[model samples]
Each structure stands twice: as C-alpha cells, then as structure tokens.
Target chain A: GIQVEQSPPDLILQEGANSTLRCNFSDSVNNLQWFHQNPWGQLINLFYIPSGTKQNGRLSATTVATERYSLLYISSSQTTDSGVYFCAVNGFSGGYNKLIFGAGTRLAVHP
Target chain B: EPEVTQTPSHQVTQMGQEVILRCVPISNHLYFYWYRQILGQKVEFLVSFYNNEISEKSEIFDDQFSVERPDGSNFTLKIRSTKLEDSAMYFCASRTRRTSNEKLFFGSGTQLSVL
Candidate 1:
C-alpha cells in the first residue's frame, strides 16, 4: 500500500488569512484528490488533480506526480473553512481502483 | 447538484449482530466506493464496486465485510458480525468515470456504534 503523509497535523488561523497544506506520497499516483471534511463529517471534494494545477474559488491545489507530492492553498479563509483537509491518492498499482488518504490537516479559522 | 445519500445517519448494534449500511449514490455515476473513518482517524477505503461487482478492496475489507449493488440505485455494505472495532463513520462515494481526474462525490457518512 502507498503511504500518504500530510504536514502540519493541526493549524489555526485568523479569518482573512492565507494558508498552505501539503501532502507527500510514497509512490507514483495517477489519481489524487483533495477533500474537506466539515464538522458534520461531510467529505466534500475540493480538487481532482493528478498533475498540474487547479483552482476553485478560494481553494487551489497542485500535484507533482513525478515528485510524489501535492499542495493545497486557501486564501482569505472564513469560519466555514474550519475543518479537516484531506489528501487522497490512488497509486499506479491500483489504477484508480481505491484511494489512500492522508491523516489530514485540521484547520481552525477564527474571526 | 446531485449528491450521494446514505440512510440512518447513526446506527447502534451489539458486537455479535449483523449490520447493514445503505447508500444511494449519484444516479448518473458508475463507480461506487465505501470508506470508513475511526474516531480521529483518517478515512480509509474499504471497497470499490463497478458493474455490480467489487473492483478492488482493501485488507480491512475482510471476511466480515461485504458490499453489494442490490438494485440499480441502492448500494450497501454489510458487516456479518460486528465488533467493537467496527464502530466508525462509513461513507459512500460515487464517480462518473474511472479516470484519474474524475472527482468523487461523497455522502455525509453513517456513524456506526458497536457495543
């Protein structure tokens, strides 16, 4: 099984600030996704980037498959953004079969 | 915006009882998956189903666990004999394709408590 590691196990930021979260994998992956788990335990897809860069609203992500790493960026964070952010990936061995998730970075945005 | 819907937001069962978790994935999606998260732990993939059969499953999806697409719209995960360790939040997800860039839509998750 491929190993996924996320940095800054916990984070705290004031509203309107910016933050960056990172994920590192142990193998080459063809499928990589970013998810935000809210307090209600709802996992919402944030990005589906295997390579290159993508952005949506105040959230953005970049995956460097060759380097086995990905980055997620949040700008002008709001209270609603407080939750756990997860990075998941499917190793080449699985061929998009199943996703292995990182331990997630818990973020707390305060006003 | 269609979403994956799951039944019984929370379930409580005895350690030796059988429990079934139900889900209704996005109608148009073809790939479905089951993932679980223990308290304060990362979400782990249990199984992936495609074309009415399991495409892939993790080690955690052992003898006690099984998945089925009973009908065209409903998918389920059954634990033959629950254990205290089986208590966790189970999530159902669906995707329109098998490609790497395809995004998965996940349900809110069903919290199972085994006593």
Candidate 2:
C-alpha cells in the first residue's frame, strides 16, 4: 500500500493572506485529487491534478509526479476557507481506483 | 453539474442493529465508492462498485458489511450488525470512468451514530 503524508497538520492564517500545503506519497500514483472539507463536513472537490498544475479560482494545485508530491496554494484566503484540506491519490497497486487520503492539513483563516 | 446524492443525512442506531445507508450517484457515472471518515481521521476507502459488482474493498469492509446496487440508480451499504466503532461520516462518490483523468465527485455524506 502507498502512504500519503501531508505537512503542516495545522495551519492558521489571517484573511487575505496566502498559504501552501504539501502532500508526499511513497509511490507513483495514477490519479490525484484535492478536496476541502467544510465545517458542515462536505468534501468539496478542488482539483483533479494527477500531474502538472491546475487552478480553480483562488485555489490552485501542482503535482510533480516524478517527485511523488503535490502542493496546494490558497491565495488571498478568506474566512470561509477555514476547514480541512485533503490530498488523495489512487496508486497503481490499487487497481480499482481506490483513493488513499492524507490525514489533511487543518486550515483556519481569521478575519 | 451532476452530483452524488445521499439520503438520511444522519442516522442513529443501537449496537447490534441492522442499518442501511443509501446513495444515488450521478446517473452517467460508472464507478461508485463508499468511504468513511471517523472524527478527526482521514477519509478511508471501504469499497468500490462497477458493473453491478464490487471491484475492491479494504480490510475494514468485513463480513459485517455488504454493498448492493439494488436498482439501476441506487447503491446501498448495509451493516448487518453495527458497533460503536462504526459511528462516522460515510461518503458516497462516483466517477464517469476508470480513466485517470476522470474526476470523482462526492456526496455530502451521512453521519452515522451507533450507540
């Protein structure tokens, strides 16, 4: 099984600031996704960047497959951005597209 | 955009009771999955279904659990005997294809509380 580890398990930022979260996987992956779990516990899909980079509004993600790592950038963060950000990947070993998730980086933005 | 929908947003059951959580994935999606997140824990995969059969399941998905696509539109997860540890937020997800580029969408999730 592949291992996914996220850094800065806890993050605190003031509104309008920027932040970056990192995820490192122990093996190559065929699919990668970023999600934001809101206070209500809804897992909102942010990006599906298995490799390369993608941007969606104030959120952007870049995955360097060769390095087996991904970075999520939140620009001009707002108070509503407070939640847990997760990075999940489907490794080749998991033939059925099973996504293994990291523990997540809990983000808090204060006004 | 179409999205996955789950019913009974919240469920409460006594230990040893039988419980079923239902989900309606996007009509066009072919792959369906069930994931669970215990409080303060990472989301863990339970099982994946395609073509009306389970493709893969994690160790956590034991004899106590079962999945069924009883109809063309509904996917259900049945717990024969619920336990206190079974309490968690269960999420249902779907993807249009098995290709790596196909994005997976998740439902709002059902909060289960086993007493």
Candidate 3:
C-alpha cells in the first residue's frame, strides 16, 4: 500500500495572500487528484494531475511523479477558501483504482 | 458536467440496526466506489464495484458490509449491523472509464450517525 502524507497540517492566511500545500507519496501513482472539502462536507474536485502541472482559477497544482510529490497552490486566497484540502492518489492495485487520501491540510483565511 | 448524487444526506441509526446508503452515479460511468471519512480523519476507501461485482475492497469493508448495483442507475451500500464506529461521512464516487487519466467524480456524501 502507498502512503500519502500532506505537510503543514494546519495553515492560516490573511485574505489576498498566497499559500502552498505539499503532498508526498511513498510509491509511484497512476492517478492523483486534489480536492477541497468545504464546511458543508462537500468534496469539490480541484485538479486531476497524475503528473505535470495544471491550473484552475485561483488554484493550481503540480505533480512531480518521479519525485513522488505534489504541490497545491492557492493564490490571492479568499475567506471562502477556508476548509480542508486533500490530495489523493491511485496506485492501481489488483488491476483496479482505489484512491488513497492524505490526512489533508486545514486552511483558514481571515479577512 | 454530470456528477454523482447521494440520497438521504443524513442518516441516524441505532447500533445493530441495518442501514442502507444509496447513490446515483453519472449515467455512463463504469467504475463505482464507496469511501468513508471519520471525523477528523482522511477519506478511506471501502470498496470498488464494476460489472455488477466488487473488484476490490479494503480491510474496513468486512462481512458486515455489502454493495449492490441493484439497477442500471443506482448503487447502494448496506451495513447489516451498524456499530458506533460506523458513524462517518460516506462518499460515493464514479469514473467514466478504467483508464488512469479518467477523472473520478464524487457525490456530496451522506453523514451517518450510529448511536
């Protein structure tokens, strides 16, 4: 089983600031995804980057497959960005995909 | 964009009681999965279903749990006898294909409280 660890378990930022969260996996992965869990418990998909880099609005992510690590960047953060950000990866064991998630980085943006 | 939909946004059940959580995945998706997140914990995979059978399941998915497609559109997870530890946010997810590039979509999740 692959292990996924996220850094800066807790983060606090002022609105309009920028932040970066990191995720390190123990093994090579075939798929990786980033999600933002809102206060209402909705897991909103942010990016599906198994490798390389991708950006979506104020959020962007980059995964270095060879290094087995990924980074999530939140630019010009807003108060609404307060929540838990998770990074999940699929190692494709037994010929199927099962996403293993990191504990997540809890972010709080204050006005 | 199509998404996975789960019913009974919240459920409360007494220990030892039977509980069923239902989901309607994106119409054309072929792979379906159930994952649970205990409060303050990372989301954990429970099971994966394809072709009307379970393809893989984690240790957390034991004899007490079962999954059924039941029909073309609905996927259900049944806990034969719920326990206090069973309380958590259960999420249903689906993907259009088996390819690693296919993105997986998740439902809002059902909050289950076992007393």
Question: For every model shown, what is its TM-score relative to the native structure?
Answer: 0.92, 0.96, 0.97
lDDT comparison, 1 vs 2, better candidate: 2
Q: Considering only chain B, report the TM-score of each candidate against the true chain B.
A: 0.98, 0.98, 0.98
After TM-score superposition, what is the CA distance of residue A44 in candidate 3 from its true location, in Å? 0.4
The positional error of residue B37 in candidate 3, measured at the CA in angstroms, is 0.3
Interface RMSD of each: 1.9, 1.3, 1.4
After superposition, which runs of candidate 2 have C-alpha atoms over 4 Å from their true positions? Answer: none
Q: In candidate 1, what are the lDDT values of residues A3-107, reduced to their tens digit?
A: 999999999999999999999999998889999999988888888898999999999999989899999999999999999999998877754567889999999
Window of ten residues with lowest summed lDDT in model 3 chain B: B95-104
Better of 1 and 2 by TM-score: 2
Residue-wise C-alpha lDDT for candidate 1, range B1-115, written one tens digit per residue: 6889999899999999999999999989999999999989999889999998888888899999999988799999999999999999999999999864566788989999999
**Candidate 3 error regions (>4 Å):** none
- Which of the two candidates, 1 or 3, achieves a greater DockQ against the reference? 3
**TM-score of chain A for the candidates in order shown:** 0.97, 0.98, 0.97
Worst 10 residues of 2 chain B by lDDT: B96-105
Please identify which of the two predictions, 1 or 2, would achieve the higher DockQ against the true structure. Answer: 2
Error of 3 at A102 (Å): 0.6
User: Model 1: residues >4 Å from true position, as ranges?
Assistant: none
True contacts kept of each: 0.68, 0.68, 0.70
